[model samples]
Target: DIVKANSREPISNEGDIYALIACCETGAERLSGMMEEFGIDHLDDLADYIIDTSYRGTIEAIAELPKGTWRNVLKVDGYEQEIDLHAALTIAEDRVALDFTGTSGLSNKGINVPLNYATAYSVFALRCIIGPDIPNNAGSLAPFHVTGPKNCILNAQPPAPVAMRHTLGQMTPDLVYGCLSQALPDRVPAEGASCMYDLPLRHTPEAVSRGDEQFALELVFSGGTGARPGLDGLSATAFPSGVWGSQVETTEAVAPVLITRRELRPDSGGPGRTRGGLGQVIEMRSSDNADFMLFLSVERVLNPANGRFGGQAAAPGRIRISRDGPDLPGKGEVRVKAGETLIFETPGGGGFGPPRERDPDDIRRDLDEGLISRQAAHDIYGLEP
Candidate 1:
């Protein structure tokens, strides 16, 4: 009966092949239906045409820029000290190359980036600056070439721990934008809180007694985006990572954590003609009387986001316990006692233009909306509250 249902099933085979045949038949039918619906007679010809068009568009995009080498150096808060991320972008008539020849050496921590991951972000950055409308594929990506020194932070060798690669990998867009900003001043935006603030929390043995089931939780949070040429940046928005913020209810339901407050921080955005996005303040505490482990791997602490075109740099990020204890480093694993509150203030984005060029009405609106404090309005924006 099974063989009869699948008409193309091999009669000589003793094993039941109905499921396998059905899957293959369904895939083949879908492909054939698509071809027929689109009236595709020559698949090879259509593929070739697509490749040729994409390649031409990519080349034309590169041809728009003047041939020159632009360089930028970015500093990241490493485990012990600051680490530098250097890039030299060379633009030619047909292609562009980014060489990470002078970046810092490999770290003894897990924050190192693999070459493939670095290249992916580098290509993404270039695409954001040039030919963003072009479809991303092999042909469209052919114009970009990225290389880095083998033992550097951007290209770690084997046997090196890279569990937290995205901590530094996501910074490539901001690093590359530093160079592109010099090439096309009007097109690029200022720096932003490029890295994500991810917290991985696991329950302790004591918490399992009060809970239904022991669970692991991951909470993702973003800082701010860089201000653009024509508009103010979005507050508490994800930049290059494109990740969504977690909901308070969703987090509370799965874990024994209480979210006390989550709101935008006042005076966190850099003031300029187009102001940068605002960072946020999040406060939480343990709901149950049980301690837990907190894994913190975040960035934009020591080195805040940089500004462009005579603008001011944004405020750096900070993490603390109850706002009274000592500030914690950007990356580490620590234990939190039960009922102890944790506070995280993310970094703000960099402004686009000079503060003097900012409109007075916008500054007034910022004061009215409580986005900026009265003191900051007077000190930074040169306005009276």
Candidate 2:
């Protein structure tokens, strides 16, 4: 019924419509089954119980926070130069408010973020660390209030280009954590590669004329996660995005490109008491006599993830035609010649504590596994290989 009501608009793509309907139907069926098992005779009663319980839990959680204002500023690789994302978190007994008054103004490019999207991520970050076990519903989210001055990057009005909003939106978690770390130092994690690496591939006109089976493809990849208080960061894991990396076989079956090499880079993770996660390297080339265009939008290029508690920063990321060639910027579109290969090195996570405090046995394990070079082991971890 919901899908039918939403089908008022003209359907330009039947496949997309079918997929949406399937997703909606699956969710509805699950909710109905849960209600039945719980013996929920009245939908209104269940709704009230959920809302009231979540609201009370949210209030109790907010009351635990120290009443004060904490501020943090983050720098991102903008269209032409660096842009700052400023956030001021104010905690009270009843609610929490995030203010972006001092953030940079909206860019002329497509990297601006809308107010609703910004607010959503801001609340999500808070919920992650505060009352994380609580059920997320309308009531649980009602205590968060996000605001930014008009014309700023976090509050861009209509007519502004926001095509790549996620480029900066995903950074909000790190930005918010900056403030929360001051209040709950033990609970927050170090900075990490928060944004996703998305690549769009399209066949060249010549390949199209040759009757290629697949003409377009999109491949998604992730970087390392920041180290935690007592554990090492996850290697090549998706953080805020919660998305899995695409399989090489899956991509090859749909695209006219061959993945030559895909593996973790040695010593990519930052060295510390609790080591950061490791990043990966990917190399690909177009099929014989077939050229393609690639679209790139990634972050942590200019300012890599920052470490915490005297730990070292993670390795920065890069993209290029070859290992020795000039590097490509974080966002742009380029053409790949038939025989030319494109290489991508994702960013690593930030360490949690001082490098010298790391366990020697763990360091030896990394060395034996070829995860770190002997020189890095001696210099970064101060250990003889």
Candidate 3:
């Protein structure tokens, strides 16, 4: 029902149905195999023990946190406008609550987030901070509660065009983390390029008329993670999502597009004591001068990830046509004409501390590996070659 309503294509749901059946069939086999290997019919007693232990551990961790209220706001580039997401968090002795009271109203665009989806991301971020080693079962998750206004972006009503909820949904971690950063300044990492850059590409109708093959391909990738208190951020890594990106080989094999370049952009990571992760630069074009269409929505173009503890903000993202062509907006469907290449530069994560505090050895290493330019080292890091 959801697939048909949003995509207006009933055929797409076949893949989901197949996966659902596959999981159910394979899941039973895996469970039986596990029981046979352990010489037990079920792990019910063990599950209870683990959940109890995890619950106690979670309680202890929550007790350690400073009890107070913290508020933070984040703005995202919606389809045609920017929308704010506000969060007020309160950590009590036994529980934690995140309230999205002042967040923007529902966007007619596909970016609205359902209440349940918003709660999932908000609580996940909290769990990562408290009881990170815990198994994160129902017991560990029981202490956190999330709520928002019914019409807010984070809790939109029906018919609000939530087909693209992930664009904003993926950002919930950052919004909640922003509040936590104020509570535990040293524990949290700086903001990062949080959303996945997934491009749904297809041959345009004109291309099909001109003999181009009909194909639809999805290429997903992500930017860097924020720099941690004691460590530099990861480059071209998927932070919040933890897993993203479709293989270049797979896309090339299934589609008529040539990926010309995929490399880390130097100096894209914010300069600081613990440098943020780097973003990627990708260049691609339709094969044999055939026109194509690309659908994408990404963040950090208008407002890059902000730094924590005096760290610097990351470089903004960019998407444009190659060969001195015009820049394109970050959202919506874009047409790619013949003789033009799509150049996309994902934004990096924010730095963690003051740039001067960075290790000189790390600076030398960055220069040796082409992570940062010599000029950036001299100017931004205040170091000479």
For model 1 the local lDDT of residue 248 reads 86
**lDDT of model 3, residue 64:** 96
Model 2: per-residue Cα lDDT at residue 364: 93
lDDT of each: 0.85, 0.84, 0.85
Model 2, residue 323: distance off in Å is 2.2
TM-score for each candidate, following the candidate numbering:
0.89, 0.90, 0.90
Scanning candidate 2 in windows of ten residues, the lowest lDDT window is 1-10
In candidate 2, the residue pairs with backbone N, CA or C atoms under 3 Å apart (3 or more residues apart, or in different chains) clash, namely none
Q: Which ranges in model 1 have alpha carbons more than 4 Å from their true place?
A: 1-34, 205-213
Ranking by TM-score: 3, 2, 1
- Model 1, span 95-194: residue lDDT tens: 9999999999988999999999999988898898788888888888988999998989999999999999999999999999999889999988888998
RMSD of 1: 8.6
- Poorest lDDT segment (10 consecutive residues) of candidate 1: 1-10
Residues 1-385 of candidate 3: C-alpha lDDT, one tens digit per residue: 2121223454334787899999999999999998899899778898999888888888899999999999999987777788898999999998999999999998778889999988987888888888899998988988898999898999989878888888899898989989999999988989889888777887787654565577776677678888999998998888677765666776676677888899998988888899999999999988767788999888778888888888898887889989587767779899988778999889899999999889999999999999999998899888975
